[model samples]
Target: MPTRPLSNEVLQKTIDVYIASMRSWTDSAKKLGIARSTLEHRLKVAKRRGMLGPMPKALDGFEVKEYSEQIGKNGEVKSRSTKYSPEGGGQFEVPDGYKIKGESVLTDADGQIRARWVKTKEGEEDPLQVASVVRGAFEGFVAKSPNIWRLKDHDEDSLTVYPLADFHLGMFAWSKETEGPDWDLKIAERVLTETFQELVERAPKSRKAVILGLGDLMHADSHKNQTPGSGNIMDVDTRYQKVLPKLCDIIIQCTEFVRHKHAEVEAEFKAGNHDPASTVAIRTGLDLYYRNDKHMTVNTSPSPFWWHGFGVNMLCGTHGDGAKIKDLPGIMASYKREMWGSSKSCHAFTGHVHHELCTEKDGTRVYSLRAPIPSDAWHSAEGYLSGRSMYGFHFHKDKGSTGRSEVEIL
Candidate 1:
């Protein structure tokens, strides 16, 4: 007989498991043996029929609360319970059609948030649109909008901790000859600065923000093993000067920008396989592969592959060498099982894989960043291709405590 059709309950449960397992629409489709677009269509159908729910249930443990302002009750807000996103973020819409950016609010007696209302240039509100707007607001889940203001000011203890990974700077790219000669470093600096500036724009306005430098800051020399002869192999000192400086400069500017913004903001860095192999080279008789002065936190061998402490929980700077994309979630689960001795979700920023991707592994979010490389080499495909595309992460400060983070393309 043909395979039995799935029951509604079974289908729903299967959908949840499928989503949790894949952590992304494209990967889910691929593993389920369906086309990515086709899988997307099926998911839409499921959502429309109301046979679906947020995988693992979005915002599961967080309670919703309300906060109202005394000024015309002007700044009104709703927020997700603090237990949920750590950031205590919430969403909202103006019923009176008032102009608004982001709001800073506190939880009310009821389990709802009273948003701090802000006046707009000229605007009107429709209650019908308010519910959806509010839902998206609290979660950093924004769609299209005509206007938005950056919101800030919250207690550090009241913020959420997140990982900003997927920065790829240390790789070289042969130009289609874009800028004049020796433009890669310049291009890298520009993009990195732009990204840092954007991050500064988003920092939370509450407490001192804690950061995890995740990994893959540079393309490192590992890729040299991937594509031989496509590039040159220089002495460690020469290559270090070529690529390391650009990355170090970006970090210096980043921390400097942070210091400019907040005196107490703390930033931490980690090493990944994408970093120079010499970073991990063992001194087996006097041969050293690479060495970094004091630029990165985990610059020496026995690289700090993982960082765990304080409220930050865990940090993984591994370059994701020899790991399959589809299997990341399981691998992370195992990492907790073996390495950390705890099951808290692991947040890792891995590089070497250029594609932009995200997945829920065990409990953590594993993001494969789109690097900020200035070469045409990574642009090639099975067919024909030219030009380049790159991206990076910007962790915007919220208040004095936690901050909001975003992804920007360069």
Candidate 2:
């Protein structure tokens, strides 16, 4: 038989178990694949290297049960008598250095019972620390849902949805360097609010409005000026401290404006590559800001995709950074199965390509929105000078899409 090379972890475990068992060297060596003399040498070397520690106090009357059973395809069980081995051993004396920290019972493909366990080194990994790390991930989310206000002369006519993807709010650019209009935090504020106003003005009166903050609403993830997920250095207008409060004010302004025109407003947010964590923070802020006001519903969830419904229309969107266009229709359908099934018309929107694109797959229509923000140095150098634009779709109560309004940046 080919000798399976033992790792340091396994060797240490084996030596510890041998000492704890108080078994003969010959018996332990035969059970393991090594010769009796080799086992003795390894034990001496392990002690010298400080890999073999003092044996743990033996558990009194701790008996281990062992049995084997093979089941046929026809559900006939056959019991077989076999020699007992350790939990992780094939034919060797199983190492007992590590106790069962935790275990989960599972069934494998062959319909056999399997036990999965988390094993740590002796006196390592505090249970309290493990629990604290797991607990830290959850943020207390309570739906302080307020009553939605309807338009005074509200006719269930149409709904307007703005696709505000890839805002990249704190991005910086110089006209002389990029040969395009200069961009910064100030310009971002203007373009987003102004374009949103123009888009709303051009659209028909609606009972409700959706002001979508697609993703990447910030250029830098942290105060140190790095991309959110990639950690790449980015061009920035100012410190995150200066931009954070101002950007939150800008969104509040947009939503407040929308609320005036429509009776109800649903402010939806999607996290982008440039501002994943920031997006969630911004959304949570918005949720708190309008918690008392009943005219708006704030959705600042950190999920990649979101869906909103209007009568017969099902509107879905993603950041467009992770998924391709062709896969979106199926993905949306799969994720929003009940919504997809019930709605007659499905319209999907995405951002991050910076250019506008439209395609139809199956019965779904996918629209890749054009960002209204001006190009930074990298986009300009790469010749990605797609015209800056924003789009708002008007959804009829029963007829699906009636029309769309677009505002362009010169």
Candidate 3:
């Protein structure tokens, strides 16, 4: 028969046998069926750690269920191991700056409960602190001096609207991968700026102009490079820190450009599924940039629905990610009852499908504008394709939609 290896239990028995034999090493080794050297080493370890009789209990708030010690041949303790569990009915407090990742509780056959918790460092930024940082940065920024431009001849009763939808500024798409035109931050900026300049030059000289950002102005809301609500991974052009400031710059440049063309300019950015928080940042940045300018009005509302009344024409807009398109007419009617009741014509605009759709029901005309951005990898792979274009709508105070200008991307 093979002899069993030495353990803490064997060591305790050996200690007792040695004492019973008047501390004789040879007698203890013979009785335990171990080598005399092994008995001597284990005894030295037991004496060194004072663990000769029984294992020590765990400290407060913890219970050591199992204990082990490895001793070397040279009468030295090599290592000690312990398995600890939270005490029964004990509260486990997660350390500061940490969050519980997972937890489990096991009830032993003796009806004693053992609890285990795994914690991870919390990494998400607080929204309030992020907003505070953005607000502070914008507040401290010294805006450039406004360019002095004389007002040109413009039609007082007309309002021109530049609808920018699904610009997807931070998106990245390769021509080979998506089977579409290559797009990135640089291309998007150039295409949108040039398109807006062309549209502005061709459209009628209206006294009031509106820069309407229908939604998805930014591709990803944060550095996670994922859809804000769905958490779907996205192909992004750059980091969020870079994209946000650039987004603000683009809007400011466009607004400044249009300010020179019209007598009064108003801008509103609607929240979208892709960029609910980013829309707030853009609107806040715009408001801060033009707060001193008398000719500019930037709507800083975080509302999902927005409306503007130009004489008898009621212009209503939403991101269109929520609420069925057909239901929008009724929604607008209920939300803007006064405007809907008084207006001669009502027009509602939305952006989400990345394609143009027009429907008129119950006296309200709802148009889903086409996005200027090219199809990304996911859309291309899914066989979703649409012509990329933006529109400029001109409306008269008494008439709804006098004319439209389209800039189609090739």
Candidate 4:
């Protein structure tokens, strides 16, 4: 006699009933009229298909109430009990396009284990797969125009570059200890917007504008609220949920502002010591937002150094944490010889120190722009007090940098 081929539907239905019964695998197998070996084999298949997660721990005599969280429109959690089985088992509806990974314990402030529930979120997909899907989805939407605006030959055409460095959008600081201006998501957004708006107003009208993110746009890289490399605890304003969208919105607003003033806008982002992964997330979100916009392009390359060229000017930028300032000119030339060979003037804008400083080496001027953000506790306690300001530079087509504008925060 040969064994019958397993039906996934039948196996899934049996597993559910077995789970609801809150019986051990052996007892469930006997009740389902199947051998323990057969039952285990089917369960493994279900696991591979993502139809099942890790088995719940035995509760023994303790009361087990299984419930699912009903999130409101505002994302507030509302608990709703689906089953009150003493042996502990519940079936929760997994939303479409998402799957439950596994259960994790929810702990309280007193270091006591509170509860355990399945963690459900978007199903894991390969990055390349996601990119391909996104490309296919927007293939028809993207216009054929590579350059929307006509390039005219002019002797005085200028491009303005604004370096928005170390915004640390979700960082928190108090007025009590540091005694400086309080810093939080709200203040960060307002100051950044106002300062950029002021810079745009002062800068001469240009054909193109580059909104350069000098990294550390996020204060914390992980849910632990710590820096990426050192794991030092950081002051955070709120959960990643609220912070991400706010940062994206701020970037969108700034891009739109520059778009209105210039024919083209290019936004370049660099990874910071504080936010290696989050910076990529920010770029992905922004790319999706501006997918169909012909006038704007978002560059989210993982490379630490990037350069943009216009006529005789080459403007290279980095986060300034990876390589020293003295080696940047050589690095830029090595990485982008075509760009370096074509341009007569080379400049590097770096932003890790969060203060305005300028130095020249080997005919390449390296400028570090000031961040308008206030000092956090660690920085203030170390007496690293530096004047906060924003900067924008005007580069001429043939004459290199024509002028620069500064907006110091009072």
Clashes of each: 58, 0, 0, 0
lDDT of 4 by residue, 263-318 (tens): 77898888889888988998899889988999899887888877899999998998
User: Model 2 lDDT vs. the true structure?
Assistant: 0.74
lDDT of 2 by residue, 337-384 (tens): 888888999888988988988999998998888888888888899899
> Sorted by lDDT, highest first, which candidate order results?
3, 4, 2, 1
lDDT of 1 by residue, 2-118 (tens): 112223554455477566875577667666777766555555434433445322222322322222223335554433222123223333445555565444545444423334444
Q: Single out the weakest 10-residue window by summed lDDT for candidate 1.
A: 282-291
Better of 2 and 3 by lDDT: 3
Model 4 RMSD in Å is 26.6
TM-score top scorer: 3
Candidate 2 vs 3: which has more TM-score: 3
How well does each candidate superpose onto the true structure, as a TM-score?
0.42, 0.62, 0.63, 0.62
The clash tally of candidate 3 reads 0
Least well predicted 10-residue stretch by lDDT in candidate 2: 55-64
Which candidate number maximizes lDDT? 3
